[model samples]
Target: MSDPSLVLHRIPETLVEALMMSLRKSKVEELQLRTSVLKPKSKVVVPSMRKLLTTEQSNKASKSVGRKLPVPSNQIRDIVQHHCSNKLTKGAVEAIEVSFEKFFKYLCRDVMAICLHAGKKIVTQADIELVMKRQRFIKDNKSLQILIEQNFPLEYRQLFIPVASSVTLKQRKKN
Candidate 1:
């Protein structure tokens, strides 16, 4: 058997060795963390104006930035042809696209305002219908009103129908 004094000395040495090993491990981990943090990040390269103007690059950039992309000119032309038996010029198609973007922005703003007034964060179809109703589009345009009534859901079409007052009903009954 080992002597008690030797055992006691060995005990302290083993404890010191364990403590040193733990300290070394912590130091190595800390150094690794420091090295990882100190590594240089790759620089972002801004594309040249010419590259940005390219269709493919612009589409990629627009998609990455979550911007509302303009409708393709061909699709716009197709829509114009569908509505009227007339072909639009290149400039006319561009003009229509710009006007559409402006109208959409204006409509979205009004819908968002309605959503906020209703204590909601997300825009809803009901909010858009409310905005359209408030804008008096259905009242002003008979054709558009008819189109909406025909295409839209029953709940949406009900918004445009005038309600008869109780007084009017009573007077009608008396008459």
Candidate 2:
């Protein structure tokens, strides 16, 4: 079979100049030839490429995702909308919601218990403090105090010093 003559054609000077300038600007000597080569070299994404996702590709991808179920009626989607605004895998969003729901349940239970015990309609910061005081888990212990300080919120930064000092004072021999 006669090898097809490799045609060496001169691209129009204007086009070649444009391509050379673009190559220089892009800091690459040559671009690989494909649909990408035909794209107008620019910082912006190629508009044509953006539109190249064929209906078949779209259909196959959409089909695999399964249809979104109708939004639930009870919960205002607005509350969760921020959490869901960004693109996330289905499982990731489910896990995050599950985690937040668990945390919220624990927080509400603690608040409710304090409110019930106090016989007060309005739960305040003092109620939270009182609960913290009564709690046997890691409230006054120095090692646990340091662990809580490192891990938990720094709302009461001064509380750590007092807690550590109180532990030392209790251990000291009084005159």
Taken over the whole model, the C-alpha lDDT of each candidate is 0.64, 0.53
TM-score against truth, every candidate: 0.41, 0.28
Predicted candidate 2 versus true structure: per-residue lDDT over 12-71, tens digit per residue: 555766776665555432432333467756443322212235789986675476333333
Give candidate 2's root-mean-square deviation (CA, Å): 21.8
Looking at candidate 2, the ten consecutive residues that score lowest on lDDT are 67-76
- Positional deviation of residue 28's Cα in model 1 after best superposition, in angstroms: 50
Q: Which pairs clash in model 1?
A: none
Best by lDDT: 1
What are the runs in model 1 whose C-alpha is more than 4 Å off?
Answer: 1-72, 140-175
